[model samples]
Structures are given as C-alpha cells and as structure tokens.
Target: MQLTQFTDLGLRVVMYLAAAAPDSSPSTKRVAEQLQLSYAHTTKVVARLSELGVVTTRRGRGGGLTITELGRGASVGWLTRQLEGDGEVVACEGDKPCPLREGCSLRGALRRAQESFYAALDSVTVADLTRAPTRTVLLDLTRPAV
Candidate 1:
C-alpha cells in the first residue's frame, strides 16, 4: 500500500522529535525550516499529530512542540495506522464502484498485503528510526546554524 505524503511527513516529524532533546520543543516554523518543508503544511501536520496525542504544543515562552512518550515508544506500524486512518487498501465501493467488487479476490489480497506491510514495521519504534546513522544525520540536520 502506498502511504500518503501526509503520513510520510507525520513520520518524519515524529522521528525528528524523537531525536531531539525532550525540553528543546522547537517551534513549528523552526521544525519546518530545519526539515526543509513548507511551514503551512507542516502546521497542519503538527495540528493533526497533536490531535493524535503523538505531539504536544505549547504557546508563549519556553514552549513549542514536544513528542509525547507515546510518540517515542510507538511502533512505526501503529503510528502509520493513526496517520493513515481506517481507509481500505482498495476502494471496492464508490460512486463508480469496481465492476468486480461483488466477488473480487483482488480486494482481499490487497488488504492482506497491506496488513503484511504494516506488520513488517511493527517491530520498529519511532525512536529506533533515529538511531545510529539516521540519528547522527537528524542531529546534524536539526542543529542550529544549519
């Protein structure tokens, strides 16, 4: 299954946060700039992530965005599910429904394939994504004066 760009960005945001100091709490603009992403789009992503309880936002001084413990420990598969929603792998029914929807084996196969894809990621936590090579890269990317 192809994950949406939104889900990709959400994962990037979570991974970046997981790599950061707990108290750093960089602002959205800072994150957007550091990540080389659009501020407006990043804002929307951050809002959704906040709603999902993976990120927390604070206003005024000494406040920005922080990843919750849930965000840190969550499996990539679980987080992806939250970001992806409960949409089916294939749209069997719609205004223009698939002709083979009535008895299609494809839909079930696709669903199972999607599940397997997610299952493969279940072993990796968000924190694990930032470890070693990726950890060093992310740390360099997030450093000030970058």
Candidate 2:
C-alpha cells in the first residue's frame, strides 16, 4: 500500500530528528533544508506529529523537535491511523450515504484488507523504520554501505 505524503514526510522528519547529533536539535528550517522539502510543509508535518504525541517541540533557546519515547515505539499503523484522520475506509465517511449501505461485499472486503494491513504494520516499530537501511542511509552519513 502506498503511504500518503503526510506519512512519508512525517517519517522523514522523525528519522531526521532521531539521527541528529546527540546534543544538536534541528530547527524546522534545518530539517526542511536537509530533506529538500518546503518549510511550510515541514512545519505542518512537525505540528501534526507533535499533536499526536509522536514528537516533542521546544521553543526559544536551543529549540527544536525531538522524537518522544512514544515516537520511538510508534508503529506504521499509528501513522496510518493519524493520516486517515477519522479511521475510515471506502465510503465509510459519514458524508454521503453509500448506495450499497448494508450489502456491499466490496466494502467488507476492503475493510478486512485494511484491518489486515494495519495489523501487520502494528507489529513494526518506528525503531524498525529508523533501522531500515535505505532510510538510515539518507538520515546519517555514518551509515555503512550494505
């Protein structure tokens, strides 16, 4: 399954923070520059992650974002849930009534698939994502070639 841009950017921001110098907290500007993304998008992503308790932000002197312990153990499923914005799939939105309301096998199948997908993802942690070789390479210069 394809991750939404929010999830992708959120992950990048978290990984960047996780890999920064132990005593150096990166400003959003630095993170955006390093990741080659817009500052506005980086700020937005950082805010959302903070709201979700995945990352903490400190302001004023030595201010910046830091991944929380919650963030350290965060799972892909958690990110997916947050990005989903209401934990829904298909015509599950309360907006318009689905024509198939009660008897849609497709909806059931899709829901099942989504559940399975999340369940599988739940088994993984942000640490797992952080340790991923490809992502590690982008976040750290000290990463060894594989």
Candidate 3:
C-alpha cells in the first residue's frame, strides 16, 4: 500500500526533530519552513502527534517541540498499520466485500503482501533513520529516563 502524503509528512517532521540535539527544540514554523510544508498542515500534524503522545510541545521562550520517547518506538510498520491499514485501502473498507473475494486469489495475495510490507516497516524505528555517529550519540542523548 502506498503511504499517504499526510503520513509521509508526519514521519518527516518527527525525523527532523529526532535529528536535532535532545535539548534542541524547534517550533512547528521552523520545521515547516525547513521541510517546505504549510504551517497550517504542519501544525495539525504536530497537534495530532502531540495528542498521540508521539511528541511534546511547549510554549514560551526556550520551549518548542520535541520528539517524545514513544516517538522512537513508533515504527514505520506500526505507522502503516495505523494509517495504511486494511481499511485505508478503500477496496477493503467497503461494507460489501469485493465481488471477487471468493474466487480471486489476488485479494488474498495482496492482503498477505500488505501485511509483509508493513511488517518490514515495523522493523525500522526513528533510530534506524540516523547514521553511525549521529545515531549513537543521539540515542545516548535521548536515553529513556531523560
């Protein structure tokens, strides 16, 4: 299944925050400007992420947005399962099953493939997005109790 632009942008925003220093907090505007997303949309995504406990947002001076510990565990596969699940694919979400459901092997095949696709994504985490020194340093910085 193809990822919607919404999920894509959401992941990107998280990645940008993850890439920065732990104490480094960037505002939604900064993230939007850097990523070329509209402030409104980015704000919405950030809000949603905040609601989901994926990120933390703070107001006032020296306050901005930061990726939450849960954000690291938000794997690509988990994202796909959440956003691009069986229902996200319209053909599967319909009240009535597809006419070819019984006779078609394609549907089952596609279902299995989709599951596999998301399973692969699940293996990757925000940590996986970073390379070598950055990842190690960042991981240490974002350690659990902090």
Candidate 4:
C-alpha cells in the first residue's frame, strides 16, 4: 500500500525536526522551503502535528516549531494508521455491491497485507529514520540558511 503525500510529508517534517540542533526551532516556512512543499500544505500538516501533541508551535518573534519527545519516539506505523485511517484500498464499498463481494478473499488478503505493512512500520520510529546517512542528509536540509 502506498502512503499519501500528506503522510510522507508528515514523516519528513518529524525527521527534519529530529535532526535539527537541540536548541534550534525551525519555522514552518523554512520547513516548507526545505522540503519543497507548498506553504499552505506545510502549514496544515504542522498544525495537525501540533494538535496531535507531536509537535509544538510558538507564535511571534523568536517563535517556531519543534518536535516533542513524543514526536521523536513516534512509531511510523502508528502515524501512518492515524493519517490513513480505515479507508478501503479497493472499490468494495458503495451503494452498488461488487460482483465478487460475496465470495472473493481479495479484501481479506489485502487487509492482512496492510496489517503486515503497518507492523513493519511499527518497528521503526521517527528517530530510527534519522540515523547516520539519513541524519546527515536531514540535518543539511534543516540547516539555517546563511
């Protein structure tokens, strides 16, 4: 199953923040520019993250965004599940019934596979994604502009 761009950006935002210097908080605009995401989209994602208690946002001068310790420890699988919800992977839900709905095991199979996907992701945390080479790369991206 493929992750939506929203989920992708959410993960990137957390990783960027995790890699940032301990005392530095990055602005939403900076996060957007560094990630090449639209400012509005970044704003929405950051807002959601803030609401979820994964990140904190401060307003006005000397204010910016920072990932919480919870954010750093957040499981990728849990985040994906929250972001993706229980949306069907197939077109099985509607007023009209699918022809194979009665006897097909496709939906069940897909569900199991999706569970496996999430289980794998569950083993990984935002901090896990920022190790070594990835940490270096994310740090570069989050670096304050000269």
Local distance difference test, each candidate: 0.90, 0.76, 0.74, 0.89
Please report the candidate that would top TM-score against the real structure.
Answer: 1
lDDT of 4 by residue, 17-91 (tens): 999998998899999999899899899889888988889999989999999999999999998888777887787
lDDT of 1 by residue, 21-72 (tens): 7558899999999898889989999999999899999999988999999889
Q: Could you give me the TM-score of model 3 versus the true structure? A: 0.76
On TM-score, who's better, 2 or 3? 2
- TM-scores, all models, native as reference: 0.94, 0.80, 0.76, 0.94
RMSD of candidate 2 to the true fold? 4.0
Off by over 4 Å in 4: 95-97
lDDT of 1: 0.90
lDDT of 1 at 100: 91
Model 1 Cα displacement at 141 (Å)? 1.8
Model 2 Cα lDDT, one tens digit per residue, 1-146: 55678778888887777665556667888788878888998999999999999888899888987788888788878777786565446755477888777776887787788888888988887777766675557566423235
Return the clash pairs for model 3, or none: 77-121, 77-122
Superior candidate under lDDT, 2 versus 4: 4
Per-residue lDDT of 37-135 in model 3, one digit per residue for the tens?
999989988887887788899999988999988886678677555544345233643688677666767766777887788888888987677667656
In order, how many clashes per candidate? Answer: 0, 0, 2, 0
Q: Once superposed on the true structure, which residue ranges of model 2 sit more than 4 Å away at CA?
A: 92-98, 141-146
